[model samples]
Target: MLTIQFLCPLPNGLHARPAWELKEQCSQWQSEVTFINHRQNAKADAKSSLALIGTG
Candidate 1:
C-alpha cells in the first residue's frame, strides 16, 4: 500500500464537488484507496463521495 499525506488546499475544506471528483478519479484504480483526516480522526473510502465528505 502507498500512503500519501497532504494538507487540504480548499479554503472551505473537502466539500461535495471535490469529494465527488475524487471518488470518480479513484474509481479508475483497482486498488483500494482511503482518505484520512488526522485532525478529525476520520477515515473514508476514496471511492465513496459521502465517505470523503464525512472525513471533513
Candidate 2:
C-alpha cells in the first residue's frame, strides 16, 4: 500500500462540492484511495461521499 501525505489546499477545507469533485477524481484511479486525517485520527473511503463527510 502506498501512503501519501498531502496538505489540503482548500480554503474552506473539504466541503460538499470539493468532496464530490474528489469522488469524481478518485474514480479515475485504479488503486484504492483512502483519506486519513491524522489530526482527528479519522479515516474515510475516498470514493464514499458519506464517509468523506464524516471526516469533515
Candidate 3:
C-alpha cells in the first residue's frame, strides 16, 4: 500500500467544494483512493464527496 501524508491548506479544512473536487479527481484513477483524518480517526473513500466531508 502507498501512503501519503500532507497537511490540509484549506482554511475551512475539507469542506464540500474541496471534497467534491477531490472526489472528481480521484474518480479518474483506477486504483482505490482513501483519505485519512488522523486527528479525527476517520477514513473516507476518495471517490465520494460525502465520505470526504464526513472525515471532518
Q: Stretches of candidate 1 above 4 Å error?
A: none
What local lDDT does model 2 show for residue 8? 84
Clashing pairs counted in every model: 0, 0, 0
What Cα-based lDDT does every candidate model obtain? 0.88, 0.82, 0.88
**Candidate 3 structure quality by residue, lDDT tens digits, 1-56:** 88778788765569988899989999999999989887788999999999999888
**Better TM-score candidate (1, 2):** 1
Better of 2 and 3 by lDDT: 3
How high is the lDDT of residue 19 in model 2? 85
> What is the alpha-carbon lDDT of model 2 when measured against the actual structure?
0.82
Spell out the clash pairs found in candidate 2. Answer: none
Q: What tens digits encode model 2's per-residue C-alpha lDDT throughout 1-56?
A: 88888888765458888788888888789999998866677899999877877786
Q: Estimate each model's TM-score.
A: 0.86, 0.78, 0.86
Model 3 is weakest, by summed lDDT over 10 consecutive residues, at 4-13
Q: Which residue pairs overlap in candidate 1's backbone?
A: none
